[model samples]
Target: MKHALILVALLGLSVTAVAQTVREPDGYRMDQYRGPVPDSLTGGRVLDPEAAHDLWQAGEAAFIDVLPRAPKPKNLPEGTIWRDKPRHSIPGAIWLPNVGYGAIAEVTADYFRRGLEQATDGNMDHPVVIFCLAECWMSWNAAKRALEYGYSEVYWMPDGTDGWTFFDYPTEVITPEPEP
Candidate 1:
């Protein structure tokens, strides 16, 4: 009986350790951009697909897709053709690729700020929905950054286009806003 109790205690400790390791970080996620995400954001609402859909139908929110663009290889042979990957996102969403990384360059930061200003028409109170792919940390980082930028109404749709399309919601191909 003592041995059985010790085994149960060890299992409990293992579960607790795993849970701790998976908790959300205090700051941006520095790496592993794709993985499970927390269910909440400190200064923004964490939205599910249904909630995002409702917001979309309301026409009062601006959806921003932050899926990163894959840059062309610099090592490709001269004359080798390279094509950019196509991305499909929720209709009417503004694609601001590469602006969601945990750490961003000054130019990228300017682009993100400018994109937000354009999306909200310079209204900080306008509702902004930020996303990328499902289980992507880029959205989380971007949402937090939006909050820091004094956006009063920010929503983080962690499931992003994956969740959006799962319900047969329509999507459209979008080009990223040019970086400054």
Candidate 2:
């Protein structure tokens, strides 16, 4: 019994250690986006569900969802139907897919910039909250980019829609803004 108890405690410790091992990268996460993320972002405020909810209640922040939309495969046979997977996010969030990649094309950068301008009415000082799914790096990248674009008040919600909905916050189906 004593040996079994010691083994269980050691296993618990190992699990805890593993859970604590996610480190923030020096720059954007280039790949493997669906994984643990750091607890904080350097230039932006990291928000939990409750804080995000408060922001939502305040009715000022523009919540931007950066979840990527998968493109239809090019190898599909002619006449094969292709449909984009629908995304549901926090109510009022503007879904700006495909702008969170570590390296983005000039067109994508333009789209992101235009989307932010539209959302904030061209006010760089407007507070903007960027998110995707929990543990997703897309939101981190988007938030970082927003900062680089000179947004003064930027918030990173790493918990994303998963955490928001977990707390029973309402969500709605949203479509991506047209690419610029």
Q: What's the true lDDT of residue 121 in model 1?
A: 99
How close to the true structure is residue 26 of candidate 1, measured as C-alpha lDDT?
94
Worst 10 residues of 1 by lDDT: 14-23
Report the C-alpha lDDT of model 2 over 1-180, residue by residue, as the tens digit. Answer: 667557768777554555466777888899988988888877889999899999999997999999999988989998899988889899999999988889999999999999999889999999999999998999998898899989999999999999999999998999999874
Look at candidate 2 and tell me the lDDT of residue 159. Answer: 94
Poorly placed runs, candidate 1 (over 4 Å): 1-21
Q: Candidate 2, clashing residue pairs?
A: none
How close is every model to the real structure, measured as TM-score? 0.87, 0.88
